[model samples]
Target chain A: MQDLGIRVLFMGNNFIRLLGGLWITVKISLISVGLSIVFGLLLGMIMTLKNPIVKCLTKIYLEFIRIMPQLVLLFLVYFGATKSFGLQLSGEVSAVIVFTMWGTAEMGDLVRGALISIPKHQYESGAALGLESRQIYRYIIVPQTLRRLLPLAINLATRMVKTTSLIVLIGVVEVLKVAQQIIEANRYTVPDSALWIYGCVFFLYFIVCWPVSRLAVRMEKKWEN
Target chain B: MEGQEKLLEIHHLHKDYGNGAVLKDVSLDIHKGEVLVLIGPSGCGKSTFLRCMNGLEQIQSGEIRLDGEVITDPKTKWSEVRQKIGMVFQSYELFPHMTVINNILLGPLKVQKKEKKEAEKEAEQLLERVGLLDKKDAYPRQLSGGQKQRVAIVRALIMKPEILLFDEVTAALDPEMVREVLDVMLELAKEGSTMVIVTHEMQFARAVADRIVFLDGGEVVEMAAPEQFFTQPETERAKRFLDTLSFE
Candidate 1:
């Protein structure tokens, strides 16, 4: 077995290919996170509705998403549904759909918690201020809820970034898949190249997620203060 | 006296929670430019009665008329009544995310749909009146209890309501802070804003209230002018309640 040299670390073509793959991962995460926030906010509001029927329906959706593993969800969207219903979905699209569903459930719960956490007197005060129900929500309730929700939502976005690695299982050529391909191709020439290549993938994910985690911490502290 | 305009009239106002009645057959009239302070022990319907005025707590039966219009009547628009009668809560529920200026401006801008510059000017004036103009840019969390409550009062006043309801405004403040809020309220009262205050501050009740109402077990036990109510309370319940409170 030939000794694997550190020179393989920054191979020009391999670096470009890895970056291209990382870009795809980031694109998928961004799209999914955006869709998740919108869907989550709507669902969360529904979950907190005064009507029992709407509340129950939202609760059911939340439970369904929480109970099912995201990997299974991705497979169902990418492979199972395509075969069973004659529906065709691209791997990247399926990845986005699955992650959005997961992120939305988590986000919806966060929103519900934030909304409910506001003191009951806030509503009474709003009503007392001669505000109509819509006006109260627009001026009083929604602003406070959004403030409480920001930190949690940021943390969820970082989690989504890390979880994007699972999409490679569905044949999406994200960073991990690219690293695997590079290591496999160079295995005969350099036996231990996979270790260094995988390490790079790990560092890449850490580099992307650490800033977001730091941002979340900073926001949490700022809000607390 | 008969030709004078009546600001508020409640006729046989009844409110119940489940099997228990909180306010039963409560009827009273408040004249224009009057400050009515409702004082009672816990579980008395003073707060509930104040809530009923603005349709915050719906009455099971009976009628509340504001400015010759029956608010409790099915045909009456609640939004209109609420817009005219602003209520301040004990907790001073200032929107924590909003600055003091925004909190004051929100009601006028959103509910009244006033122009931005107009609302800002009104808010600034109201904040100045409350002695909080310097803290206009500060969030509710950054303000003290007294400051927050003052901001809430200013927020309510920016709508320029015909009547302001105070649901124990000073009950939530520190001992020292209570005077500042009470001072603001006194100024509002002096400006001839018709007010219905539910409070335990007997000193304030005697100082600012034109009439004092004593409520017990959800019923109006006695309603008299502040001088008569404080000096010669007719009911044994009122005297007993006064004995229980350290009003000095």
Candidate 2:
């Protein structure tokens, strides 16, 4: 009888360890996405300001983020910052920081696009109705911007979740890292186990990300009119 | 119009967009309970002139007074002044997310800080006046163009403004829908609402206006009663403008 490699997952606590690793990935992504939304909204509004200095600064920031890759940003923060600044940041904290920086920039640009797409007459109507600038945003601009922004922002969240896979490179023992450890330990005993181990990792990622992608698509279709 | 007090005064108003003049040394006075119509060629600044009165556009050099208070001063709080002046745009510009009643009540409840119950009651009355009482809970997108414009008017009117400015309000409506919106304006005129109107609807202008101000090249060329202005314009430019309109 041929031995099936699927038994490798239940041999010890390998599956549980993979789940724990996934929790770390999710925790890092959750904190980073939450922070990005708050900061991104503020950054988005600032990007739309008419002031020359503010507009220039935000333009530079957006361009810099666009020009640099997220993987490089993670490396710079995790490896370079620790050496240059003599700081001790855990791999998880560093992952969160880099993802937040990337997420905020992407989310901020989405917000700016949404804000400017509203017709100029909307603001004029608010002013004509005697609304103060703050009240104009609260009553007219913010609500409309949110409607246009939520679906795009939700898509960014799913992308961030998938991108968290890169954190394993920075020494975070997340899912992929756990999968590698299990495969390495079983190389002699279960020589054919590599395929099953990787397949499980793929399934883990699918389970977490599929529903979120579906939600974003549903929201986009609902508001398409 | 002779004995009525001046509700709005414009003195030597100069406006430019940092280039050539859009409104050049223009001045006019609007009396209480009078309907003043401004007719002009496109880009002659009739809309810009109306926007200036509401402080929506900054003037290079000028003074505007409402009830004898200088409103064009940079130190002036335009929000407070705008509450006294209501404007309806060429496009209806109603908030799409809000229902008819909420749109009308926004200025009253948020800007005026009125009690919600009181504001809602006034909103209903204004909506009823515009024959949109049944659309109080309807969103802007669900209504016809004329219906939306009327709701825009109701939105402006709920502020209880001292004067109303209409900048080509019916220009975007269908030929059939135009009359319904104009009829509402005609009723407001009969009710003695102080109004400044810019329109291409010459017949409605003649019927609703106490006086007609003809403008060309950003300057007022002739100001006279509508009956005389329509029949016999004083300036060559004014006569030429009417000639072009008749061709249309």
Q: Give all candidates' CA lDDT scores.
A: 0.87, 0.92
* Per-residue accuracy of model 2 over B1-248 as CA lDDT, tens digit each: 77789999999999999889999999999999999999999999999999999989999998999999999987988889999999999997998878888898889989999999989998888888888899999888889999999999888888999999999999999998999999999999999999999999999999999999998899999999999999988899999999998865
Candidate 2, position A177, lDDT = 96
Compute DockQ for each candidate against the true complex. 0.57, 0.65
Evaluate model 1 with DockQ and give the value.
0.57
**What would the per-residue lDDT of candidate 1 be over residues B62-181, giving only the tens digit for each residue?**
988899888897776777777789888888688777788888887777777899998898888888878889999998888899998998888888888899999998898899999999
Candidate 1's displacement at residue B229, Å, is: 2.0
Pairs that collide, model 1: none
- Please give the range of 10 consecutive residues that has the lowest summed lDDT in model 2 chain B: B239-248
Question: Second chain of candidate 1: TM-score?
Answer: 0.96
lDDT of 1 by residue, A91-198 (tens): 999999899999999999998899999889888777766677887788778877877899899999998998889988899999999998888777777777877888
RMSD of each: 3.2, 2.7
C-alpha lDDT of candidate 1 relative to the true structure: 0.87
Q: Which ten residues in a row have the lowest lDDT in candidate 1 chain A?
A: A1-10
Candidate number with greatest TM-score:
2
